[model samples]
Target: MNSAKKFFQNLAKYLAVALLVFIIVSPIYWILVCSFKPTRELIRVTPTFVPHTVTLFHYVGLLKETGFMTYFLNSIYVATGSAVLVVILTSLAGYSVYRCRYLGRRFFFNILLAIYIFPRVLLLLFLYPMFARLNLVDNLLSLVITYVGITAPLNVWLMRAFFTSVPLELEDAALVDGANRLQILFKIFLPLVAPGIAAVAINSFLMSYGEYLFASILIVSDRFKTLPVGMAQFLQQYEISWGWLASGSVLIILPPVIAFAFVGRYFVKGLTAGAIK
Candidate 1:
């Protein structure tokens, strides 16, 4: 009877988890399905879960007609630049906070946490004017800088946690062998915390890739606009191109999905790094 009761409990738990997953994933699945469906089928009174006619019309048009490729490349540059900068800056800062003895180290970390508590939009008030003065207002560099600022504070905190998990004995041993701070950081600490670095890269890239508000306001020239802002151009005053929108959405989601797919194991390890030991 106890075994039978435990079996039913486990069954119920699995069923609940399955239901939650379905609820979360069903909308994304619908968008993928609709991206390939023709306009007539998309606008039909009755919804069809499966497309009777699968067409690549929207995808082809999206590439050929729109400046999507430019926007895509722009997003890639900005996001990649931002992610790299964030990883470098945060890893150094986190390591310093973890390893160094300083008077205001706790105070510095508290300030970072405090900055991260506020919405990034609020920073734009000061950021826009500063960038405008520096002639970076319409530049991709501005976006990269903005993303690093927003992503770095939180990532520093994350990296610091990872840094703490590394035993100090390793650092002492490296010092005993006459290795300098940079060598210790590069050879000993970084390799051991590689999962954490991957996690930070993914976080920074995703944040920069999909950001719309700052991208829209900071970028003036159509040529330099990121994917999110460029995608909004599909919304004309008269009509919204649902097919193009759906197709674009599917394409925009691919990079982050691919990144996570490749590095997801590392991300999981990063999060659970110190949990067991």
Candidate 2:
């Protein structure tokens, strides 16, 4: 009787998990199906769950007819630049805060947390005028800088937590062996906190990649617009290009999905390590 009860319990858990997975993946599946369906099928009174006729016309149109490739390249440039800057700056700042004894260290740490907690809209409101004054508006560099500033605080905090987990004894031993601060930092400390760096890089990249408000507001030139802003073009005053929108949506989500698949283990480890410390 106990064995039977255990088996039933396990079956119930599996069923619940399967249901959750279906709910989460249903929208993605719908989008994929719609992307392949023709416009007539898409706008039909009765919607089809599965496409009878698969078409690559929408994807081809998006690439050739639209500025999709330009938008894609712009997004890649900004996101990659912002991620690298954030990781480099945050790693060094986090190490200093964690390892060094300095004036107002606690105060600086508190400020970082406060900035992270604050609403981003407030910052954007203040930053827009400054960017305009500096002629940074409608530029890719502007997006890169804004994204780095927005993502850096949380990443710095995360890196600090990771640094705290590294053994001080190891650093002391390195120092006694005549290794300087930079050598110890680059060689010993960095490798141990690599997972944290990966987590920061992933977070920064995704945030910049998907960010809509800043991208839309700051970038007025079509040539400088990122993928998120470009995708909005499909929804015009008269008609919405559902096929193109769906296809673009698929492309937008693919990069992050691929990135997570590659470094997902390190990302999870870094986040968990920060939480525990």
**By lDDT, who's the top model here?**
1
Across 1-277, the per-residue lDDT of candidate 1 in tens digits comes to 9999999999999999999999999999999999999999999999899998999999998899888999999999999999999999998988878788989999988888787577767888889999999999999999999989888988876665577878999999999999999999999889998888988899889899999989989999989999999998755633888889889999999999999998776666656663455
**Residue-by-residue lDDT tens digits, candidate 2, 63-145:** 88788899999999999999999999888888978888999999987887787577878878978899999999988998999
Question: On a 0 to 100 scale, what is the lDDT of residue 119 in model 1?
Answer: 74
What is the overall TM-score of model 2 with all chains considered together?
0.93
Worst 10 residues of 1 by lDDT: 268-277
Misplaced by over 4 Å in model 2 are none
TM-score versus the correct structure, for each prediction: 0.93, 0.93
- How many clashes show up per model? 0, 0
Candidates' C-alpha lDDT:
0.89, 0.88
Error of 1 at 203 (Å): 0.5
Candidate 1 TM-score, C-alpha based: 0.93
The lDDT, on a scale of 0 to 1, for candidate 1 is 0.89
